[model samples]
Target: MTTQTSTQAQVIPKFGEQKKAFSIDKLKRLVNAAKSMSDFDQAKRYLCSYFIPCSNPHGVFMWRSEIKNLEHILDKNISKLICSITKVFYT
Candidate 1:
């Protein structure tokens, strides 16, 4: 008698498709660093660049306290979009 065994296919993640581990400590550090800078606009641009992944530049304000501040920097529509995106990532 002969027996046959089946092998399962291995899954490979595409390039840049892998999910990065999020660290709140790292985020806090970055936020603090940004805050220390003299130019808020320049700092915000840098922060936004760091936070956004892939192509489009999306502002990611991680803290709740920052929402009001971000509203002042960015328009209400952009803030709302960022808020929604942040919720999806965190939750």
Candidate 2:
């Protein structure tokens, strides 16, 4: 005679919706304003203060890659703004 064993796994419940701490509208406005700036110094100041760093390197790399890939999609003015922002924040 032969005997067989079986195992069962436990399931976890999914969490509910999360609330954001910052104001999306305000952030959008701020970013839009920064994008419109003609001076690099002004744009750099705004981005350095407003954009926070992520803990993960992979995420950051992906974000940079995405930005590069989408560069053509953004307006020329916005691209200059982003370049200044990146120079300030990444450095």
Candidate 3:
């Protein structure tokens, strides 16, 4: 007996057709869409930068986190949102 596994290809949207500025709302929407499709979008790798201590220069170095797989967020739902927000805190 022989067995085989089939694979499917993902269709990436044709972006860059029109020049446009990056919008936080748009990025968030696209990332959310990609999550439902079980696909990976390079744009999901954007970095989030914020200052700690809920202050400006008074805070230490800027805190940064890589926006990894949307699955992490999708799995946790709002809990992940809360955690990501709390991560802005300093060590």
Output the number of the TM-score-best candidate. 3
Scored by CA lDDT, what does every candidate get? 0.32, 0.29, 0.30
18-55: candidate 1 lDDT, tens digit per residue? 24433345334334443223423332443443343322
TM-score against truth, every candidate: 0.22, 0.22, 0.25
lDDT of 2 by residue, 1-91 (tens): 2111110121211111112222334334344444223433332333333333344331111112223321122233343334432222221
- Tens digit of per-residue lDDT, candidate 3, span 1-91: 2111111232223322222333455445434444333322433332222212323323222222333211222332433333331112223
- Return whichever of 2 and 3 wins on TM-score: 3
Going through the candidates in the order shown, the clash numbers are 0, 0, 0
User: How many steric overlaps does candidate 3 have?
Assistant: 0
All models, RMSD in angstroms:
17.9, 20.8, 14.5
Order of quality (TM-score): 3, 2, 1
Lowest-sum lDDT 10-residue window in model 1? 1-10
